[model samples]
Target: MLRELLADTIMQSAQLAERPEITTPPPGVSAHFSTAVAMRLAKQEKKSPMEVAAAIASKVQENAPFGLFLAVEVAAPGFINLTLTPDAHRGVLAEIREGGERYPAIPRKGGRTIVEFLSANVAKPLHVGHLRNAVLGDSLSRILEASGEEVVRWNYLGDWGTQFGKLIVAWRRWGQEEELQKNPIAHLVALYVRFHKEAEKDSSLEEEARSEFRKLEEGDAENRHLWERFRAMTIRGIDAFLVRLEIPPFDEDKGEAFFEGDITPLIAELQERGFAKESEGALIVPLDAYNLPPGMIRKSDGGSLYLTRDIANLRYRLDKYSPQRILYVIGNEQSLAMEQLFAIAAMLKLDSAQLRHVKYGLVLGESGKKFSTREGNTVAAEEILDEAQRRAVNIVNE
Candidate 1:
């Protein structure tokens, strides 16, 4: 309101001086008003900038129509500064008190946005690395919604992949029903860590894991049932952690497996459009024209990779939600992969939806190294929250 008043006063003074081209000063807190319009007018009128400023200031003070300013003065060469009356400040505060929560509202014309974050794989527990992703993504979604944007908080879980294959193998070998009943997520992480250790000792374990995963993918009843149980347990664990942290529930919890059937058709369409080509035994999209490395969609083993699943998932999202933009809150390490994905999407002529990768720096331990679950050098998200709660309790008692 103060800004509007100042602008109107400046504009009126300019019109009265017959200098309609003179621009009004923008409202600022550092000074009530300041503009170089006087200097520009002086240049055209063949007079000193200070002289023009004085003439404008005198005219504005004489009118003083609103009487909302303590003083309006010409400073230095051609600057105009206005000090608001004390009543103006009091009035602004009273208005804010009356308005309460709806004091300020900004409207956005853009359509709905999908914010994807905290996409942790079900093979492990939520770690310190995921904390940053969750906090940043959730905060951004809240801010966008507050600014009048329609937001979809998406949790794109990494429930499908080779890691799941290894996890299945480990769980079948070492998983005990009693331990799982006690703590599902912890038991699963232990199994996952053990698998890596055992696979290191017996290289053939890697092939076995792959085979088991393939069985799951091929609709083997036992493997499918086990996978479903693990998925459910992991989701339950995630929900508990979110509740502990006071984070809101996700709008969508779709995983990569949800789009498994879409991969074939998506790849076929890419190939039909001349975007995909056979490179060696794998299917790849050549990005030489874009000065980027080729993006591999399928491996020599005829297995689809992350790129393939991502493309299919993007297609599904565009078709289902028809969002104006898709924001992926991920680490900086995946910047190249994201670039390649967007490039392939563009080549496929899927340019209607905007794709954004909101990359953040890695969260490192005190040793200046990245936190890794596989390396067993990471802090669990639950532990961090527990420690914070403990400290708060101590403070309350004090």
Candidate 2:
């Protein structure tokens, strides 16, 4: 409030075309507030910055209302610094007191924000890497919601593509009903890992998996049913993890599959609009103008790529939510892919919404190695739960 008052005072005294920028003076500056309005106006008036600053300081000292400043002084170059009177500081406290219990709330800006995070592929355990994404995204959603924005916490599960096809093949070959019922995600993870291991031994398994995915895309009833079962089981497991960790549930769990139908139409539009061209039998959006590599939208096999789905997702978000901001709380390793996504969006000339890739770093194990499935090591789960419970108890007692 005081800074705003100071800004208003500067705006009036200097007769500024716009309100001047005001800020808290850094320590050792010996002032409560500071502005550089005079420096910005110097070229307009054909006067040196220091001369302009002195003139504004004199006028502010003479006309500032409410006894706001104990002293108004001109500092180096063109900074006009004000040392506030005690009464001015007391007035700020009175304003805060009037705000009462609702002080944390902000004025509404009339737009929603969607934070998509912890988007771990289904059929995998929630690991340390996913933990960072969840915590950061959940915290950010809370902060934005408190700031009076309607926030949608989304978990865009990675439920589509060749991986599921391979899993379906693995299920038919080796899956047991008992094992699946025991722990769905863990069993799916094992079956998927088994598929990769067998694929190493038999080269034909790769083609078989791809064929299964094609059938799935064509809506084979058996393949679609299996995929739905996988998704349902995985969501239940993921929700249990979130409950134990106290992370909130997502408003939407629609995965890459949600935008699958839109991709074909989108690709056609891109080609029609001259934004896409065929390269090596794959559809790509050339990004030479953006100083980036070509962004592949469809693979040579006619499978829609993640980039294509992400572009469709952006369009869907605009149509469905019209959010002011869309934050992708992803990992740092995918920075380049995120760059490509944004560039491709620009190529398509999609409606504008702030698309931010809020990247986070890896979670190092106790031995300092990044956690990997192939490495066969996991942090002590009981230890983490114990520590969390202890802290929770302490909070309750206090």
Candidate 3:
């Protein structure tokens, strides 16, 4: 479509007819005229660029469409720059009139996709690193949706882990009853930080945390209630923050614990398919092809890890939605983990469900470092939104 209209002008002129190539623009200059065409062409023709440019300029001035090119001149070694007239500049405005939003971009014909991201542990406060992941994933989902694919946004909350047992112990020990009622996420993060610091000091705390985790896994009513309460309060807090930021938060599945009752059969299926094997008492899937040290499905203590839960989650999604693709948006550091997971999934013969991992780079601060909050050396995620708003307010006042 583009070539039909422009080919006439390109072919008729003697200089352009000899030119082997053409180009659009330059790096630093922003002009209505396409500047780099003659330079790009001269190289292909194997001619001295200034001579080629001079010849091209004469032809361009004579045969240019709408008498647009005011000048065609050689700059530096071989740069042939072309400047357009005011009348030629107005053509861009005419194109804008022709197309509104669906202008020149081609539409994608991909099938439905499931995007899973922002699976931060409910026990801790979201840090700066998590903020970037959340924002990037949310933006990408919007772009996919715009391009005509059905997008199912998900948050695989990290609710099931050994850390919960420690949190349960810490809550019973130093957690304030009133502060938790006021702001549960902050209280839970404080308790989690304290529990890790304590466990480091007193090694016996590890065993205690393990015992508590086992009790939680076994569906002890008291531990279950505590976990549920913590999860609910934290989700509420996160919802408030998302609402303030005007971000559409995903429909959260919470974690593997949410589907714990149904995972037994899936784990059995993995073992039946020979995808799962016992390695030092832990159920693992050897992913040599992926260059990963086996993906652990279960720990030596007969407790399930992330792989087991993911396999179960994959099966559940396939049965429920039958989506064409599943996108895992996480940090680049976990590339090996995702590769292993997909390899194991293939071994289990669930290859129909397409899996994608969109890894993103860090949003560095002014010092060209990963943004941090607690240490004053980097910008905090919490403060970024407020700072943007303050800048907007100042600009409006000016």
Candidate 4:
């Protein structure tokens, strides 16, 4: 936030810092700096950059803002360049000392924020692929908290999904209860990987998986028992891993799937509010205003999606905490979906609740490609962590 404010302020202050004559003809060339301000102005003013630079230089004199510059120069095509005196730099230093952290910084205003992150599936071990969300979400939550916003850090685990059924099948087929006693996550991951391998040749495995999921969803004793055990094991592993990385434990809300049982009324409310509509037997909220791809609320199979569950979750949050804002520290890949969600929320007249999506770019491999960690993998989070630690150790020792 401060970064954004400073950029704006710097541009504004630069204009005022220059003499009127220097800035009038060029429009944007400032007498206080030397970084293409005149060239940019020339482009905007439809003149040669040199002409802009000359016009700006003509007005520069001793009596500039902060008493920083006495003259300006026109360089190359149309660049107004400035040579600042020692007093200017010293004054800046003084300003820095006086302002402290708020040196051109946006003051933290009180508000409530909900941060959802690290939503990996429960059936599989949280792999290297899931590290970005965990780290990024956790970091953003910390930053928000530090900035004086009341933050509710949510993990939103992908625990309630179809993959769990496959895990259940694997556990019944070839799982060892004794090994799970030693290390639950490793034991479950082994079974999960084995299940995937076996399911390839045996097509009947898919049906078996679905049956297991149905039983679990219907609250069958055995399937529920297995899922509980798996969820506990995975969460425990995640906690330990986060500790090892020195990252604080993320708050958990378990995401949309966890709230599905309680979202029917939410869907009804959406219909009442005219936010959701039935399209080809599935529920959808049209997102033309958002300029995004169509977002599905519910699938034809009677299963809900993130959008529907999010509406329910938002309503729940609104009712419970009455938060001022919802911050999603998500990856850039889901930008369109997030925009659509925000648009729908707005259409439902949730103007009081500010919805923000902080998206980060993809972390690419050194070769500028998407990273993978399989046999032919280019990148792995664990390996990156290990190497980082190694470098730190070397630096400390040196």
Candidate 5:
């Protein structure tokens, strides 16, 4: 914002056709801002840079607002350095006070936006990767809101999938009600990890997991109750983490399982409209036009995939909230999946709202590799904050 104000001042002072570049002075510069536009103009105007700098600085000081610039000095190498007056500093503080909880920004008046992030699976603790996603998404939403967009923070949780079945199987085998009550998320993660370890030895465990999920899909009462319980427990743990991180509750939190009943009709509509075709016993939408591999709607076993549920979610969003834009904060590993999702949306003509995948890089550890556990990205995000707090308290004590 100060840059914009400075650019305007320079444009008026020099009678330039365009605004000059205003940049922050480096450390130890003893100035708030600096610009080298005089040097740039010297090349074209055939004048010495010092002369141009002096002329602009004099003109700027002459016409500057009262109490705006304490000093506008011409530095060597044709730079114009500006130091702000106390009044200018007070004005910035006033604006920040007025903005309050919202992030301060020059308003763009952009339309409504829905940012979806931290869609962690229901079967595990939020990992370090998810922590970055949460922080980035929350910051972006605040920024977007400050820029005059009606921001809606949505966390489209991953509450549905076959892995949940494995978690259920493991839960039945070893889960204790009292132990799970103490810390459900950690217990869930341990169960999920143990399920894989046990399945490695007994291959039949995989089928059993699938059968459990099939029962879930068929709306078996016991399985449905377990699914609901697991979903609720996971949400409570996520809420505790949010409180620790100082992030407010999300505006919307409709998990993938919320669209379970919608996925079947969605696939039917795609097939009925000729957008989907059977490929090797799986329902898929051909994305050859976009140079992407076909997007799978349903697996050969008649289960819904991520993209399928995502389309259902988007369709619901468009029909209900009708946000002008939707952003997905996910890792770069899902770039191809996002592209396929977007392409299929285009094919289906779901063009009411913009769809974006805000891809992020992996969070690395001291070893310069991705921070992950043997169970794959199960390094609990809450532990990172706890460790940092512990170190901070240790330093304070010392």
Candidate 6:
């Protein structure tokens, strides 16, 4: 409105002086109407810029065309500054009141958006690192929803992988059923930690863990049951912590296992499209064109990798939701992997959906080291929240 008023005044002033009509204000003119156009006009008319500004200001004040400006002053060096009127402010308030919550929302032109986050492995507890992922993703999802975009808050659980096989082996060998029943998540974490420790001492355990994981992948009944029980228990524990943190419920809690079936066919399709190739008895999508390393879809041991499941997940999401945007709220370290994944998606002609990796920095401990479960220096999400609550209570008591 201010720009329109300034444009009209400039045009009328030019006509009055029998000069070339100024249709638009200079580039420096903002929504607040700060313009150096008067100086340029003065040079063209052989008059002082201040004199020309005063003339334009006088014409605008007399006409009071839109009554938008409370004051239009000719500042030093012929700069015009406009102050919006109380009436204009009142009008904005009225419009805001009429629109209510929708007043400042973005138009709902874009389609749905899927925000995938927190994706912690079921074999471990929700740690401090997961907190960063959760907070960033949850906040972004809420903001998108508030801005009038339909958002699907998704938690892509790391429920399938080689770690699960190691976890299964650890559970079968040393896991006490009674202890697991008493406290599932803590017991699971202990099993995971113990597995790594044992693997470090006896290297063959690594291959054994891999074999167990392959069994889980190959539809071994007992291993599948164990994995499902572990996943369910971990999710319940995660939910309890999420409630403490006030993170809203997820719209979908689809694990990597949900898209496991999609991997084999997707790999074949990629191979057929010449996007994938056999390299060292494994299938990989060459990302050399994108300046990234090849994305491994399958290992030499017939093991499906995260990239394989992710490709399947992407295809599934594109087919089911048809979202305009898919956001992966992952760590900065996975930037290269995400770039490679999206590049492969493009190679397969899956370029319709916008893929983004919202990367965040690490959440370091007080000692300035990255949190790690293997190091036994990691803090659980629940413990952090409990400490925060304790501090808050202390402050309230004081």
Every candidate's lDDT: 0.82, 0.84, 0.73, 0.69, 0.86, 0.81
Question: Candidate 4, residues 291-359: lDDT per residue as tens digits?
Answer: 766678878877777777777677677777777887877779888878877787788776677888878
**Candidate 5 lDDT by residue in tens digits, 65-160:** 778899999988899999999889999888778877763555667588999988877757788888899999999887787778988889888888
Which has the greatest TM-score? 5
Provide the global lDDT of candidate 4 against the true structure.
0.69
TM-scores of all candidate predictions against the true structure: 0.77, 0.71, 0.70, 0.66, 0.83, 0.74
Model 1 bad stretches (over 4 Å): 1-103, 107-110, 391-398
Across residues 1-398, which tens digit of lDDT does each residue of candidate 1 receive? 44555666776855645333323455553454455667778888899988988887777777666656678777777876667677877887888788664454557657789999999788578988888889999888877877778888899999888887888889889999999999988888888888898888999989998999899889999989888998999888889878876778999999999989988888898889888899889999999988899999989899998889988888878888899899999999999899999998888766778999999998889899987666667788888888988999999999
Residue-wise C-alpha lDDT for candidate 2, range 106-224, written one tens digit per residue: 87778799999989777767776776677899889878877788899999989898987788899999999999999786687788878888898998988898899999999999999
Report the lDDT of model 3 for residue 81: 59
TM-score of 1: 0.77
Point out the higher-scoring one by TM-score: 2 or 6: 6
Per-candidate Cα RMSD to the true structure, in Å, reads 4.9, 6.7, 6.3, 8.1, 4.0, 6.2
Give candidate 2's TM-score: 0.71
Indicate the worst ten consecutive residues by lDDT in candidate 4: 16-25
Off by over 4 Å in 3: 1-110, 289-291, 361-380, 388-398
Q: Candidate 5 regions off by >4 Å?
A: 1-29, 34-69, 75-80, 85-91, 94-98, 103-110, 364-377, 395-398
Better candidate by TM-score, 1 or 2? 1
What is the Cα-based TM-score of model 6? 0.74
Q: Number of clashing pairs, model 3?
A: 0
Residue 15: error of model 3 in Å?
28
Superposed on all Cα atoms, model 6 deviates from the true structure by an RMSD in Å of 6.2
